[model samples]
Target: TRATDSPSPDVSPDPSPSEDGDNSEGAVPEGYLGSWSGSIDNASGHSTRELVIRQGEVGEAVLTLTAEGPLATGGTYRCVFEASLTAEPAEGEAVRIGPSTVTEGEPMASCTPGSPTTLTLLPDGSLSRENTSSGEKLTYTKSG
Candidate 1:
């Protein structure tokens, strides 16, 4: 598949709280409730990525990532993954995603097949993600 031909992931906005004040089970952290999009260019190629964070059914942060770009073998591909937020310490409560699970496409050799990932939310409402294993770093801005 080509990068432009890749299907856009379903990115719904955060659900509104119920009328009866019953948001206990689905209360997502304020800082992590939005859609972010960005692209990274490197020697291999450029990739367009989107990240969506929303409240989970059990009052946890659910993060979904969709990335599409060219492959080393001369074609394009898309991959999607989902993860739940876990505890971590950072300058303003970084939102970490993991024990992540790939939800689409074959696992790329560069990214950790089954490891946790962290996303640092800057004070200016931007996001920074770094994959130490693959030495991949990307900066994303909040999407309107």
Candidate 2:
């Protein structure tokens, strides 16, 4: 049988559901909430950032980044970022806004987020994300 396409690809007047019943409740997966740590380095120096994600019922995730410096004048710094994520096509997914990653590295990420950050957990307990604007690839390794 031939499949028909919907007129509007976005914000369709009629919405459909998925198999996982992800839409049962508009919220993020419980697994997304937790702490992720990674090492970040640059020409300036090396540093680390730990993210503590707190999610709400609506799949909204609040992240806190405790970072050190890669610059000569750099020192230990902490940045707090709040973003509301929504799995529009499904559920438990979200989009966020933030700085773009300046560079890439091992252990952790060196740069930042371009737009809102989209973070997903990997089976190995690592969090991988691509900076929205710059598309700088970053993967945060687990500390424990």
- Give the alpha-carbon lDDT of every model: 0.69, 0.56
The digit string of per-residue lDDT tens for model 1 on 86-118 reads: 654354665666566667874465444446666
lDDT: which candidate is best?
1
Q: What is the lDDT of candidate 2?
A: 0.56
Worst-scoring 10-residue span by lDDT in model 2: 100-109
Every model: Cα RMSD to truth = 18.2, 10.6
For model 2, the superposed segments whose C-alpha errors exceed 4 Å read: 1-26, 57-61, 74-76, 86-114
Question: What TM-score quantifies how close candidate 1 is to the native fold?
Answer: 0.65
Indicate which candidate wins on TM-score.
1
Give candidate 1 misplaced runs (Cα > 4 Å). 1-27, 57-61, 88-91, 106-114, 132-136
- Give the per-residue lDDT digits (tens) of candidate 2, residues 42-61: 77777666766665444444
